[model samples]
Target: MAKNELHIALVGNPNSGKTSLFNALTGLNQKVGNFPGVTVDKKTGSIRLEENFDAELIDLPGTYSLYPRRADEWVAYKVLMGADADIKPDMVLLVADASNLKRNLLFCSQIIDLKIPVVMALTMTDIAAKKDIQIDINGLEAELGIPVVTVNPRKNKGLTELKKVLAQASRMNQNLHARDFMNTKKLAPESVEGVQKLFPQLSEYAAIHYLINHENFPLSDLDQKAVEQVETVNKFNPNKTQAEEILQRYTRIRQIMQQHVVEHGPLEKKMFTEKLDNILLHRTWGYVILLAVLFLLFQSIFWLAQFPMDGIEWLFTKAGGWLSTTLPQAWWSDLIVNGLVAGLSGILVFVPQIMILFGLITVLEDTGYMARISFLSDKLMRKAGLNGKSVMPMISGFACAVPAIMSARNIENKKERLLTILVTPLMSCSARLPVYTILISLVIDDKYYFGFLSVQGLVMMALYFLGTFMALIVSYVMKFFIKIKEKSFFILELPIYRAPRWKNVGITMVEKAKIFVFDAGKVIIMISLLLWFLSSHGPGNRIEKVEQKYALLAQQHPAQADSLQKPLSAEKLQNSYAGILGKAIEPVIEPLGYDWKIGIALITSFAAREVFVGTMATLYSVEETDDNSSLRQKMDAATHEDGSKVYTLPAALSLMVFYVLAMQCMSTLAVVKRETRSWKWPVFQFIYMTGLAYAMSWLTYVIFS
Candidate 1:
C-alpha cells in the first residue's frame, strides 16, 4: 500500500513461462500461501524496482482467458477483473507465449480491453524461431497500446528491460482512454450500460463480465439481485455474448498479426522434437521407454544418494557419540544425545534421497516428458475411471500426498477429481522413503545383478509400482459406486522437448529438502523427545523398583555387571509407560509379527509416516550401549521375547506393506477435508486405507512367516 510500491499481477496462459519470469525477477524472495477464502495457492514475491522503491508481484494461476472454469482459474479471473479485494493489482504483467501467438493473443487482447495498464512479456521466442516465425515487437506493442518486452526467463534475459518498463508504467498516469481491443459495447450495449450504471468505474468489457459472472463475484445480495434484474430486463445471453466477444477479439487479433507477424513458410521437414517423439511416443516403444526411464530414476535415487546419506548418518552418529562422551553422565545429556540427535539423524539422513527424487522429477517435467507420460497413460487412466489429468497428481504424490491432492483441483470432472484425491495417497511418497529404505536394508540382501542392478533398488521400485497399481485398482472400483456420471475428455498439450533447466531443477531440490527437514523435522524432534521420556520413565515406582533390583543384581555379580546391564535396561524399558501403552496395542498387531515396540511406532507414526524411523531411533537409543551404532544396525539387532530376531523378513515386509497402504498422515486427511469441503471423505479415507493396510500386512506376515 506504499505510495511508491506497485502491486503487479502476473497473468498468463498455462506454459506461458510466467513462473520462470517470476522466478527471474524475484529470485529467492518469494513465499506461497493460499488466497483468501480459497485453498488455491497464491505465490507472491517482492522485487526492488529501484532504490527504496519495490514492487510486490502476485503470480496468478494460469488461465487461457478471463473466463474461469477450475477453482484456480477463477482465482486469476477474479484478481484481474478487480473483484478480488485481497489482490487488486495496480497493473498487470501479462506473459504471452510467442510460439503460439494467435492463441496467446486472445488472452492478451482481453486483458488490454479490461482498461488496466499492462506490460506484456513475450516468451518462447526460441520455439517460435524454430517454426521460422518472426515478430515485430515494436509494431505489436504499438497496435496493442501497451509496452512489450521479450524475456527469456530461463537464461535471465530481457528482465532488466521488463523491470524498467514496469517502473515507468507504474509512474505514468492511468490511461482510461486507450482504444479497446474490440468494440465490447457493441456485443451487448444495453446489458453493458446497465451493468456500468451500477458500477460506474467498470470498462465496457468489465461490465460485460459483471452481466455474466455476477454470481461468482464478491457482490452483496442487493447488488447481485440488481445485476440479475439487469440480466432479466436486457434478456442477456451469457454464452452468446461471450462467443461474440471472442470472435470479435480474434478478428481484431488476426488483423494485428497480419501487419506485425510473419510466418516464413510451412515447415519443410520434421523438427528434432517431432522426430524424437516418434520413438518416445510410439505406442509399442513408448511404454517400454517409460518403464526404462522409471527404472533408471528409481535406481539412481539409491545410487546417487548412498554416499551423501551415509555421510549424514556418520556425522550424526559421531556427533551423538561425542556429545554423550563429552557431557557428564546425566538425564539431560542422554536426552540430547539419544533423543534429539538420534531423532534428527533419522530425519536428515534421508534428505539426500528426497532431493534426488524431486530433482529428477523436475528434470522430467522441464524436459516435457511428463506431459507425454500423461498422454501415453490416458487410455489406462480412463480404464481406471480417471483421465490423463489424474496422472500428474498421482505422479506428484511420490513427493507428498497433500500437495498432490491439491493439484487434483485441475481435473475438470468432479467424480474423477474425487477419485484422484481418494487414491493418490496410495502412491509411495518421499516421507515413506525413510521407512522403506531402512526396512529394505534390514530385510533385503545387498546382492547385485550384472554388477550394477541392486536387489534393494529393485525392491524399492516394486514398492512404488505396488502403490501405483493399487491406486488404479481402487479408482476403478470406486468409480462404479460414486455414480456421478459426467462425460470426461483428456486434452493434453505436449510441449516440445528442450534441455532441462538445471537451475530450476536445483532450486526445486533445495526447496523440497528444506520443506522436508524443517516441516517434518519439527514433528520428529518433538516425538523423539516425548518418546525418549516415555521409554525412559515408567508409571508409579515401577522404574525405581527395576533400578533397585538391577543395582542389587550388579552388586551380587560385580564381575558380571557389564553383561547384566543389558538385561537391566531391557527390564526397565518393558516396565516403562511407553511399554505399557505399546503392550496395550501389541495383541492387535501381534498377528502381523509386530511386538509392543512396533505397535508404539505404528501409533506415533500416524502423525507422519517418516516419524516411524524417529520413533524407532528414540526407542532403541534408550537401551543402546553403543552410541556408534546406526539405526539400521540397532533395528537389525532388535530381539523378540523368545530371543528371536525382531525385524525378520516377514516383519520387515509387513511393515513396508502397511506403510505403503495406510493413510497415516494427519496432514493429508486435513487437506482432503478442506478440499472435499466435508469430513465424510477424509473419514472414509482413513477407515478404508487402514483396513486395507491391516489386511494386506497381515497376509504378507502370514505367508512370509
Candidate 2:
C-alpha cells in the first residue's frame, strides 16, 4: 500500500479552550462562517511553522462524542470521517479540558480506534492543577501511543512546544503520501486551505429531523459491517447503541481511562468561587445576590454611561447644528440634517451605554461566573422543567435576547432549547429600557419612597421584574407540552477564577459594542433622518397654515415667543412638524396621557424604544437636557389645545402600561426572526405583545378615568 499525507482534525467539548488554542497558534488570521445551512458557527485557522511547511488544523465544533446527536455534531462527525468530503483525516488532535478529562477522552478513544494518529492538548492544565488533579503526560502518551501535550492556552503556556510538535507531525504526513489519489493522495497544499474554507455543512435540521431525513448521515462502517465483526473479542456490549454512534466511543474511552488517571481532593473550589457560590447558589441567598448583581448591572448602565453618552450627545447635537448651517436649507439639506444626521447621531449617542454593558458582561463571562449561575439556577429552571443550560441564555436575555436565542444550540434537548428561545424575549432586554424610562418619566413621580426607591425607579424595576415573571409563567405553561425523556445533567465545569483578563475583556467589550452600535445605529440613523425630514417638510395646507400662524405670531411677539419657551420647543404649539403630527394624533392618544409631542415621540420611538428620549428632545427643539431642565419638566408644562393638563395621571398610567407590554423595538424582532429561522415566531410575538399592550392600556384607562 502506498503511503499518503495524513490530515488530522482538532475536536473537543464546548468551552474546552479549543478556540483559544487555535487563536494563539494562528492569531488574527481566523475565518468564521456557518457550517452550511445550519446556523452552527464555524471558525478555522492554520499555523505556519518556520518554512513553507505547515500543519493544517481543522477546529471542529465542540461535541460530546463522535455520535451525530445534534445538527452541529453531525457536521463535526461528517467532516472527520471524510465520508462526505471524499477525503479522510489521517490523524486527530483531541483537545480536552484536563479538569474534565474523564468525559473528554470519550471522543479521543473513538478517533484512536479509527486508526488515526492521535495527539491530545490537555487544556486548562492550570485549572486541573488548582483542583489538585495532576496528569502525567508521559504516562498518558505511553499508554495511548500518542503524545499528550499539557497547555494553558488562556495563559499562553506550552505554545512553543506545541509548535515544535506540529512541525514534526507535518513531516510524518509527507511519508503517508500515496501513489494513487483514491486511497490517500498527497493533499494539494493550496487546496488544503480551500478545503478548510469549505466547512462540512448539511441543509438545516434535516440532519436532526426524525420524520424527514433520519437516514441522512453519510455512510458508516458500523451500518454495513457490524454483524461481520461480532467475534468473541467483539461480543455485543449492552452499552453500545446504533442510535447515534456515541455510546461505543464513550464506552471505549471510559475503559481506557479506568487504567490511568486517579481521583483526588474534594469537588469543591477553595478560592473566590467557594465564597461566591456559597452565597450565590443558596436557595434564598442566591436570588438575592442575583438581584444585587442585576442592580449594579442596570444602575451602572445609566450612571457610568452619563459622561460618555453626554459627550457623544453634545458632539452629535453640534453636528446637527453644523449640518443645518453648512448646507442649503432645502430638501437635500433637510434630509441630511433631519433624516440622516439626526438619526445617525441619536444612535451614536447610545454607543457608550452599549459599551458599558458589554464591558460588564465580558468580565462576568471570562471569570467563568456565568457557568456557576447556571448551576445555581438549575432547581429554579427545572421547576418549569427547563434544561439547566437554559439559565445562561435567560441570564443573557438580560443583555439581549437575540444572542440568548442563538446560543440555545449548546442546549442538548430540542424542546428545552426552543422554549428557552421562545421565552427569552420576556427577559427585559436592553432595548426595553428606553420605553420603560419614557413611560416612567411621563407617569411615575420621581419622589422617593421612604428615602430609597424613587417611584420612577420603582416603576422601572417593576417592568424588569414583570418581564422576568412573564418568562417564568410562559415556561411553566410550556413545561406540560415538552417531552424530556433524558434528565439534563448540570455537568458544568467552573474554571478556576483568575484575575480578570482586562486585555481580553477590553477587546470583547469593544467588539460587542462595535457590532451593536454599527448595526442598530445604521437602522436608527436612517429612521431618525426619515422621521426628521417627514416632520420637517409636509405636503398639505394644514401644515402650511400652522407655519403661517406661528410665523406671524413670532413676528408680532418675537419676545413673547422667545421668552414663551419652557426650555423645550417641541412642547410648543405647531412650531415643530413633530409637534404638529403629535397634535394631529392627539385626539386618538389623549386618553393615553400623550399629547401630540408624546405621540410624535412614540411614533419615531418604534425604530428603537430608546429613541423616545432623543425624539422628544428633537421635537422639543433642545440640544440637551439638564437638572434644572429635563424632558419631564418640558412635558409637564405643556397644555392641550383645550388648555387642559396634557399629561394627567390616567393618561400617564395608561402610557406606562402600554410601554411595558408593547413590542415596540424593531431590532429585537429582527433578531428573533433570524434566530428562529422563521418569521412566524416573531410575527406571532409582535401580534401577541402588541395585543397585550393595547388590552392592558385600555383597561388602565377605563379604570383610572
Backbone clash pairs for candidate 1 read none
All-Cα superposition RMSD per candidate: 3.7, 7.9
Candidate 1's C-alpha runs over 4 A off are 1-4, 326-335, 396-415, 429-464, 481-487, 518-520, 607-656, 665-682, 701-705
The local lDDT score (0 to 100) that residue 434 gets in candidate 2 is: 60
lDDT per model vs. reference? 0.85, 0.64
Q: Candidate 1: global Cα-lDDT?
A: 0.85
Per-candidate TM equals: 0.88, 0.78
